[model samples]
Target chain A: MRSVLCYGYGNPGRQDDGLGVALVEQLETWAMAEKIPGLTFDSNYQLNAEDALAIAGHDLVIFADATGEGADAFAFRRLVPHATIAFSTHAMAPESVLALCAELYGKQPPTWLLTIRGSAWEPNGALPAAAQANLAAAVVFLKEWLRRPPAAV
Target chain B: MNPEAEKVFNAGAARANAAYAGQRRNVTINPITRLEGHGKIDIFLDGKGDVERAYLQVPELRGFEVFSLGRPAEDMPQITSRICGVCPTAHHMAATKALDSLYQVEPTSAGKKIRELVYNAFTLEDHALHVFVLGGPDFIVGPEAPPELRNIVGVIGKVGLEAGKKVISMRRRVREITSYFGGKVVHPVLGLPGGVSKALKAEDLPKFKELATAGVEFAEWTLGVFKSIVLGNPEYVKMITSDAYTHKTCYMGTVDANNNVNFYDGVTRVVDCNGKEVCKFTAKQYRDFIAEHTEPWSYMKFTFLKDRGWNGFAEGPESSIYSVGPLARLNAADGMATPKAQAAYEEFYNTLGGKPVHHTLANHWARVIEMIYAAERIEQLVNDPEITSPDVRRIPTALPTEGMGIVEAPRGTLFHHYQTDVNGLITMANMVVATGNNAARIAMSIDRAAKGLIKGGHVTEGLLNKVEMAFRAYDPCLGCATHTLPGHMPLRARIYNQSREIVQELVQD
Candidate 1:
């Protein structure tokens, strides 16, 4: 079975760390509007190496997480599994877990981590103007990704 | 890098160990997750048989107190609820109570019942999350289990699918009840100065009863599973009951006139293990009894019982008293009033004794027992005809110059004190978070457990995970604990210490 699992990873309490959740929320809106099919979504603040085991059986796994890199409010990059560590901001980077899964299970899903650049992560729950700009960009990307069938490796 | 080699470099091994007598070996977890804000765990090992020192560091420096300087007193609960999502209701109630205290306004008879019902709903929701989501895995998956299996999904996989579904269903009930009362689970905005923002509707009572009744059954089944799987095991029982790291400290919490566990508007009481009352005071009197200390590296504050002051690593439980959430609250109370809670209370007291439970491992068991209490309390509240009344909220007409709110969050007792000027703008604010209450205690427990488990600086990943899981037993929401993470380090430790003390003192992030 070709399973599609989508995740939104970011610290929700942190202002724009909420982007991943917000992006997923926005995608839910888009999914309804554009009628995307064969997709299931789960949003978590962070998923460590061990937690990734739950994503088993997925053929196409789309991981969306927050990134501290802010050349742009948000940028769309099709990340290879290894690229996740460079941009991922979590306890156990998505790449590290994906690597572990590959080593243990002989294979991993065709994984791509989509990072929505975050600007606000201060103590105060303040969202920056640039982070707000990414909301639309993230939603647009999700809509496009959903509009097509899963790309096999 | 290899951990052993890294440890040699970090510890300074033979040279520093032999030469520097005054130097101490320390390990610090810079960021502790699932807590209110920011804090760390520091372990000072003399590399000897005993734990040289264990400090749970809470160094909140963003000054929510100062941040609230210009906000309205009426909005204290809402603002403070952002202090933590897990215990938003605790802050909300505490803020409301503080406001009422400042205004010297007590809720009417109906308002009292409404507050109680709402408080019950809040506790049930908070406690359920901890039981099913946070603490459940340890018991269900077994403490020595693999890291990948140490979570809710693991619990579901190990236990029957039906049992897992029951936990989820009960959690949904809890969320539903809280949502019905508070509008949403993320940040509740229901409480006001004198009472809640909204009252229970007629339809809410029956629906609530149905959900709560189902929850009661679920809790019982879950507890049965926990009893067989966790508490029943000889090793688990020994670990929890052993005196190896038992920290005996004074227990403080709110209790009603009859000495029953109360979440809102109760006399603040502290009792010893023998159930002797050490002190009796009001929530407003906390400042007189509690003082906060800060570590340089952490953004969380360590609050100690004022009289005891700071007890440096004397070892055992006495030197490291810790508290918060239902276990502490239960230990502080003489008896439970809610029928199910009372019955469970009798059993728990008989088993554990009538004092503060010192075993951090038991925290998971205590949490599940409280889940029973929360579920039962919900049933009682929903069955009461008053719960159905539409008079759920009573808006405050004026803001008080000063207010203090205190409610038992899922983790423990939470207090929010706010001071406002004549213009009703907040001048000062302070939050005694639930996790903060047990900060010292958790550190001590982990230190003792680590010392007992770790031989000659050797520890299995499973042991390390258990130490971490012990902290999870509190179900801390570090989001509220370290609100000032992205900011500059609070302070550097001291001279002779190349490393920051706070960084060395707190649990791992």
Candidate 2:
């Protein structure tokens, strides 16, 4: 079965840190309507590389997280798996998690890390305006992504 | 069919169950959807007929304040825009507002006008999204309707093709306008300390004018649909009329010289129900007037009007103090501006007895009124000659190190305060988003709604839906409320019987 795993990873309880989680929540709803059969949807909070190993066999893994570095929330770009994850606030870095999955499972799932720009990470997750705006654009993007057929490669 | 009756039945069943004979129960809802952030609801049911304690849990790990510590001030507007999608313009604007305060330089007339126009663009988009996309689904499809149908897609099915298209088109128009100024709708990067980064030119004027006109038409149509569906409908009318819930108003918002709608800048005023101002203060004075309450169960912070201090929840028909957002702003304003909306506002006030409209359910009415106001404002703004001026931004001074900005978001008034070093890197920051202001009110409403409607037995679809709808009315953003997911989201709705015993607890897997 060809499955599409969409992980919107963020700590919404953490202000700008929640961009990833908030986006995934929106994507999950959009996927329910647009994602076809043989496709399963999953979303989780920030995870470690060990947790990433659990998703090793999924056909495609798309991860969304908030980066203080990005200037905008919907600034979508393809990042190589080699991108460093040490700066990530998550329990484990994205690169480390994917690397562990590949080393253990022989082949890691194809992935895309969509980083939404954030302003602050207050103690109680009070997201910034930029992160909030990203929610809508991210949804539209996910809808578009689901509309496309899976890559032949 | 009787939503309130379900509550009575549940209460009766609780008394029958020995386990709940004398227990104090606490129930929490992690994320209430349809807004930017997530929040929780915790109610303590005393063994008797009343609620002993109720807490609204907005469990968010504070992010905005800490993360911006080392970032430069020039990036504040763009960075702050990340706070919420529904009101990024306000965030960006407010950040600039704070920088303006820090610099002690009044924006050029052209700059202020452009900022106001930008703010209004957000108003048009945010308000429309809330009423139609977020709050619309519940009212349009009916709360008891299935989950699948409680969305914009469901709205399309009932209202037909054109209405849905209008909504999508309006959203797109707002998005286009946002992009024109800030480059994109999410986390717009246009505004800076001295002024905006982009200047409006002659070419964009016509498009702006066209969109404004289209938005006004769309708003009028949308309002009519809302009237027929929620306010005019016999079922909804009955549900709201029932004595299950009520609140009093000590409302606040920014207003213009004539005490009309002002989203960008104005004196902050708190008015009573009779259209009398309780107190008026500038945005800078907010620190003295507002008091914040934090709880362990929820991450969201609750703000209370400080003059009278914390008044325990309101009793039946007495109306307790609650505020912010469109409803609160309308209550605080002297009157609506546009003749059409003003006339509508007068009718709305007369029907509801004007000013300090305390019922949380009344937020729906308040939201509709703002949509009308935004349309009117959009028309007047686009027509203004100043909008086409090229002097949209000014070079900000690098002197001041601290500043604050405030604007009314779709949900309520949002505040952003920041301190930067001489080099412009942020040293400290504080923010009070919309949902936080409504935190106490949300819990109070939930407690009232649950107590008045759910007695704790079998969860009837109508009863459960009404309780959920009460939260939905605020367009509560659980995403903004909950910063961390507990490994996975927990879906649980539990109802206890009258004797304070557990009756039914359903968990969604």
Candidate 3:
């Protein structure tokens, strides 16, 4: 069985920014009910250097985050190890994480980014109706995507 | 859209632009990336193009205190931690300590030790991140190097792949110790009212002991790396002691009974520019010593010494403006509590020309010394017999009222204050984050660097980086300083001519 790691990061306290983690939560529940094998779930407020090691251990990884940019409700794209200078210690781009993994751990597992559209970012505000719709659509698409064989993915 | 209305709008915009073109030129470093949150530096230039006044603005603000109102006081530890992903543990520990003060209950000896152990481990890792990644490019990879050669990748190239791997491994192990207790390093759930939610198990002691030992070794090696790479280069040392980065402001930090630097708990100590003790106060008495001064130009409130008063951005013995963080902490305390760190402290002072080194760039060296202290402290705490004791909490019976808690975060001193009603619901909440405490001094640093570097309207990428180096040494976390979302923003610097027309633009991704 191929080991797959699903990592989502964003501040849940912020209204629409929580879409990434919210999707992971729903995905985890569905995956558990289906008794999916070799699939792991993790989350945090944002991505950091330590996450490189986490992705290195898996055969496949998916990084989920909410994006203020993009016209579509959700977009998924394959990731390559690309090193970019990070501005802050608080967070790092998904590509940078993959780059760090390749450099430090000598492993560049197949990776993908799932960006869901978000609008509001107010503190303590609930997810807006539009963001919820985007999240649901992303979740449905992800469930189908995850069911595919590792080689095909 | 009507054509006549469009014409009218265009004419109005032209008039406004023409008016702005006649005004004094301004140089703005917007969205200063690579640090937490969004920061912008605006340097207003005189007619000759020399800097007149510079302001550092934090545009994004979250209503954290307002959000805390009407919530249960017990929820603060969790809620406040969510404010910044970079320093969640600092907020968690501060809020936990505040809860102890609110309930008027002391944590069991074991619980206090556990908290200390976890805190030191966090400091070691966080400081490592800054030293190896965030601040590394400036010194480690050489400030004069090209932008592409001045990042973590560059540091790896200079230090070799093995060293890079070691840093990742060491940070992973150190954070493991934090996650073991807090349940998660990002948003820890360990702190309770009087104690921790869980106690350290005996079986886990061996692994912690091993990790602590490895952490100390790693820190010692890091100190050696700094000694060779940063301290060995005379140019780097000259830059560190340069006048543009020097400040004569007061310093503040927490210290133990022996006047040694402490991160977890101690009396707050304040020292003047000459390194003489100004005052010592408890967490509850912070208001008597420190006050926040507001300016209409920025969202951040500058913290100053209350007795001396707010005397603007001037730096001297009489100036109320003070700084916190590694260098300040070292200057405020007599020595480090641990032996190896104490020797390092002596070397740092001797090499830098005695107590209270005034150079801002010296903060990078001071931070490395702190790593030694944190690692040694972690080793001491984990080996104590009381570490494994299960008596971690005491029931609180006292009524909730007003309480305050303070901790030395990796960046600087952090304070959490709360007032609760009879039902234990929060009435008011306030926090004095490290970046806010250093805001005034940071503004002065930026202004001074801009004046020294940019002359005759010439702003080079290297020069602007030097200006940024002044504040980057502080490792200011604007995300934690203000309650804002932690997101990455590109760095852009725009210079407006005397007529307020765009003269030059520089952008970095």
Candidate 4:
């Protein structure tokens, strides 16, 4: 069985900041109904060091998050392990978790980061209309991508 | 929406959440600035550009009391734990203990052990994060480093990438252990009213034993790192022992039956600055001894000993100011129960001039020692013969009423109190979080450090870093209100109904 791990991270309470979480929730529904084998899903406010172990034994890992820096639509990019590790009281970057996988597990899976563009960050806020459109577009793309064969990686 | 809701929160996040809304992002709020949607640290300046007073305006999260009304009392362990992302386990354990009191049932021996095992694992994780993530930059990366360099990344750069890998890996191992027992590390769900739902099977004990053993070695290495970086350097030690970061307030924590520092359960012990025991009280008597003074500006109330009266934020015997957490636990106890931790504790006091060390920066040292104890305790727990016993819970059959539970959170002493109806429905729920307890000191620390560092309206990144370090030493955990809606309300009425009662509610400017 080819194991794939989809991990989404963001502060869902902040408007549009929950884009990553929203995406994963949609994927979970699709995966469950379709009975997509060898797929596991997890979500949190931010990626932490332990998530390295969470993804350690899996063959492929995809980290999903909402970004204030990217374009309004969405950007999906492959990620490589970095040699540095920096932590905080706030949150950890996706790349840092990937790096830990390499350092601690003596193995690194092929990984990608799906960054949904977020336009707002109000506390107890809702995802804005435009961001919701972006989320819908991204979800469509992700659904197609997941159905594709593993050779695409 | 509750009137208090309009006064503070938007509650949009709570509303947006549907089935499997996934993990919440709004749990880690600090003190909020009412209706403003964000917290601010206001520094009032005098004519000469000298600091008058600095107040960290912690906005109150409104309607939680009202939000939680009419819920089954048993749901509190799960609900209250959702308040913070960082220390959910602390809140969960406190609520569970309160449940025990409310139901008037004692957990089976195995059940209490399971809870402590998981609780100690979380303490280990929390302290490691603080030492390496929050406190590391100031000491490891150098105090005078640039703004960009004053972070865990910079600390890793100086401490060697190998150490970074070990730190990350070690933290993961401990968290995994916490999850194995508590069901999840960030927001645990295993805690129940009488006892835990799961037991430590003999088969899985080996994995936990391996990790707990690693935890001990990790502490030894971390102490060595601290010794070389902070204590070994005279300048660092001087700064740690400096007057600007010192507070001569009283200390409080829970101690075991032997009077050693016990994080899981103990009586509340309060000690003066001179290392003299002031008073020891049970969780029920917390009211007679402690009082919270609320300021219009902060959502959090400043806690002090009632006998001293609310003397404002001044730090002295006459003033009611007090501190908690690792330093407080150490000061309030006779010693640590574990041998290695006791040795470290004694060395810490001796190095800092013996008993009730006043230097706040030494909290980092005290915290490390506590982590050592937690790690050792985890090992001891894994070896217990009854650790695998199936009798993990004592089915509660007692009447419901009022109950209180206290625990030593990695940050400080955390208090959770609840009052329920005869049918076990909650009527009242109140918490004076570790951060709430330290609110006055947090403000005072900023004030004192600002007076020393920020001169004549001039402030550099380094100077501000120093001031930031003062709060960092406390390792303060603020209520992180990140959600658009109040998601903590598993069952809601007050945050909504209270707002309905308030026909005219205005957002404070």
Candidate 5:
């Protein structure tokens, strides 16, 4: 059985910043309804090095998170192993989690960083209309991708 | 919940929502912000740039008490497990034990062994994470290293990559053990009123045996790393024993009849600053000995010994401000329950000069030793003959009533109290979390360290980190400390176990 993971990271309390977390919520429902096996889903405020262990042993891992610096829709980048030890602390960058997987566990499978463009960041902000639309598009794309996670970006 | 506590939570949440702007008069470090629940360190300085006071404030807007009022008592372990990811096992176990008392039943011998095995494994995982990632930087990397280099990365840079790999491998193994026992990796769902929801099968014995043996080897390796990098260095040793990071606070923990530290179950022991036994109290009598005092400025309550009284955060034998966790556990007990930890405990006191060592930095060393014991205890529990027995639970047959449960959480003693109606619905709920127990000392340690390092009006990043080191040693869970309200983490109520009769499920939309 091929193992695949989908991790969404963001603070759900924040408005549009919760886009990634919302996607995770949607994916959780989809996973249960569809009864997907060897498919794992997780969500956290941010990624930690321990997340590397979480994503370990998976053939493919999709990292979804809110990105304010990205385009209106979303962008995907294939992640490669690199030294990100210096970029670790209270939270970690998604790339750093992959780097940790390679350095600490000896093998980091092919991974993708899916940056869902967020429109706002607020302590009590709700999901914005724009980010919601973008999330819908991203979800549609990932629904097909879950059937066959790409070999590369 | 009290109105005054509610008022405090509102006030704290308002203040915590502000930006992490370090004003000229103060500095903040190691603040957990945003969705993790806001916790910021504010160091108020005098006009001349001298330290006046330091406050570690955390926002408390979680309405757990109000929401859990009408819930079934049996589902508390599953419900409270979502409180924080840091110590879900601790909360689950505490809630499970509280159910045991409320239902007026005891777990069978196999159930007891299973609980102990899981708890020890959790201890091993939690302590390893703290010593290697959280508090490890200060000792593994040079304490005086730059702020950028003073983290787990620096520890990896100093200690070879193989050691780093072992650290991750060890933590992963223990987490797997917890997942196997608890029925889930992160949020476990296996606690029951009388016993656990599931039992360990014989097929999993070899896996656990491997995990326990490997955990022992990893713990020994961690100690060796501490010995070579921390104790082996004269400067680090001196700093650990130095007065800057030292406080003469009383100690408290749970101990067996032989006065040995026991994490699962025992009487609560309290000792003076001089290591003399003050009193030992049972779980039911915790209110008589321990009392929590509220400060209007903070949401979390400050706990102090009732006999000693609240002496305004004063540190001494005369004060009720006692410390907990590994240092306190070792100090309050005569010795460790395991051979390896016992030897380490002896060397720790011998080098530091006597019982109840006041040096707070030695908390890291004490934490590592406890990890050693936790690993060894796992080995023993796994080898127990009844570990796989089918006799694990007894159905409750008594009326629901008030009950109290206490256990040694990774940080310290965790207390849970609940009062239920005849129909087995919760009426009252209260808790004294381990981090909340260390509030007085966390404040004191941060204040004293800020005073010592922020002198001469030149506040550098190094100085701020030094202050943070003091609080990090306690391994304080600011999220849980201020977890009065789930302002950030929205909870959903689902059917935990629906085989029952008349269990209503309601949640905030």
Candidate 6:
């Protein structure tokens, strides 16, 4: 079985921005109930340089995050190692993490980005209905997507 | 916005427009990336195209105090940690300390040791991130390097792949120590009122000791790297001590009883421009020493010394504005508590000319020295017999009222204050984050760099990178500095002519 790592990142305290983390919670539960093997989960408020190590050890990696701009409910796309200048130490783009992994560890696990369209982002606010719908749709899609062969994904 | 704020905004805009009446130009660097959250830089030029004024504006996260209202005071450690994705541990520890103060109880020796251990581990890893990944590129790859070549990958390219692996390996090992005690490295669940939730297990002691040893070694290696890469370069050293980055201002940081820098706990100490001790105050007495100044154009509130008073954004001893963070911590203290760190600290001051190093770029060096202190401190704490003792909690019994906590966060001094009712529910909350404390000084640095580098309408990417380096040295984390609704802002630069017409606009998304 191919090892799969699902990492969700965003500030959960910020309303709809929590979709990625919330989705991971549901996915973990679903995966466990289905007794799916070779699947691992992790999350944080944001991604950092250390995540490069975590991703390198996995056969496949999926990064889920909330997006303010996107027309679809969710967008799943392949990721390639690309280094971008980040202005803050607080977070790093997933692509940057991949780039670091390739640079330091000489490993580039096939990676994908799952962006769930989110509207509300108020701190300590509840997730809006629209965001909830988008998250549900993304979760459904990811469930099927995860079941596919590693190469197909 | 309130009437006063609106008035200030109008007045600022009017002043800028009037200054631009003689064919001046405006350069706006919107949404600075990387450190934490969003920040922007606005530069106005005179008729001759020399920089007239430059302002750094950051967005503030709203309603955090209101959000904490009526919540249990004990929840602050968790709730406040969630305020920012970065530096959650700093907020966690500060809030946890506040809870201890609120309940009028102190943690058992073991509990305190455990807290310090985790905290030091955190500082080591966090500083490593800045040195090797975030701010390191400015020096490691050279500031004049192309934008694409000034990142972690570029640092690895310059420093070699093995050194890159060492940094990654060291961070992972250090953070493992954090995860062992804190439960999660990002959002820790370790701190409790008057104690930590878990005691260090005997079996975990050996592993922790090993990590601590590695941490110290890693820090020393990093210092060597910095010396060879930054200090060895004459141009870099000159730039570090240049007039553009230098500021003679008061400094603030946490210090031990002996006046040595302490990250987890200490009394707040302030030093004047000439490195003279200004005052020392407890966390509760912070208000008597510090005050915030608001500007209409930015959400960040600039902090200043209350005794000296607010003197605009000007530096020097006359101005009330003071800086915090690594360099400030070193300046405010007598020396590092750890032996190796003390040596590194001495070398830092000696190489930089003397005490109270005013150059902003020197912050990077001070940060490396701090990593040594943090690592050695970690080694000391882990070896203490009480580190694994089970007597952790000293159960709080005092009635809830008011409390305050302070810590030297990686960026600078962090303060957490809370007022609670008899029910131990929060009635009010206030946090003076590190970035907020340095905001005014950061503004001054940006302004000075713009004036010094942007001469006669000539602005190169290299010049802009150097300008950004001024603030980046402080390792500002605006995400933690200001509480705002969540969203990403696009990076853009807009240039306007004397007529206020947009001559050119560049956007990065």
The interface RMSD values of the models, given in order, are 9.6, 14.4, 4.2, 9.7, 9.8, 4.7
Candidate order by DockQ, decreasing, is 6, 3, 4, 5, 1, 2
- Mind giving the per-residue lDDT tens digits that candidate 2 earns over B86-140? 3557778888898887766678777787777777777777677667655666677
lDDT of 3 by residue, B1-509 (tens): 14565465345334433443344244322332222334556555557876555455665354778899999999999888877777889999999999999999998888899899989999999999999888988999988888877777788888888999889889889988888888854357889888897889999999999998999899999999999999999999989998888989999999999999999999999999999999999999999999999865666799999999987776677878889999999999999999999999999999999988999999999999999999999999988999999998888899999889999999899999999999999999999998889998998898678778889888888987888788789988876321122235445555554555567766656
lDDT of 1 by residue, B141-179 (tens): 676766566544565567765665455445545666656
What is the DockQ score, from 0 to 1, of model 6?
Answer: 0.47
User: Per-candidate TM vs. native?
Assistant: 0.77, 0.72, 0.93, 0.82, 0.82, 0.93
Error of 3 at B278 (Å): 1.0
For residue B329, model 6's alpha carbon misses the true position, in angstroms, by 0.2
Regions more than 4 Å wrong, model 5: A1-3, A8-48, A54-56, A64-93, A105-110, A113-139, A148-152, B1-38, B480-509
For TM-score, the strongest prediction is 6
lDDT per model vs. reference: 0.60, 0.64, 0.82, 0.74, 0.74, 0.83
Q: Give the per-residue lDDT of model 5 (tens digit) for B1-509.
A: 24565465444334422311323123222233333334455554445655555566655434455556888988678666645556778888888889989988988878878888889998988888888776887778876786556556667878978788778777877877877877643346767877776788999899889988999888888899999999999998888887779988889999999999999988999998989999999888999999988764466788999987876666666878898999999999999988998999999999899898988889899999999999999999989988988888878899989878888999999998889999989999887888888888887797678768775456655565677678778887765311111112211121111121112222211
Between candidates 5 and 6, the lDDT winner: 6
Q: TM-score of A-chain in each prediction?
A: 0.78, 0.80, 0.96, 0.93, 0.90, 0.96
DockQ, Cα level, model 1? 0.11
lDDT of 5 at B147: 54
> B97 in model 4: Cα distance from truth in Å?
0.7
True-contact fraction for model 4?
Answer: 0.09
For each candidate, how many residue pairs have backbone atoms clashing (under 3 Å)? 46, 71, 4, 30, 6, 8
Fraction of native contacts (fnat) of each candidate:
0.00, 0.05, 0.30, 0.09, 0.06, 0.40
lDDT of 6 by residue, B118-214 (tens): 8888899989999988789999999999889988899999999999888988988888877887875445789999899999999878988898898
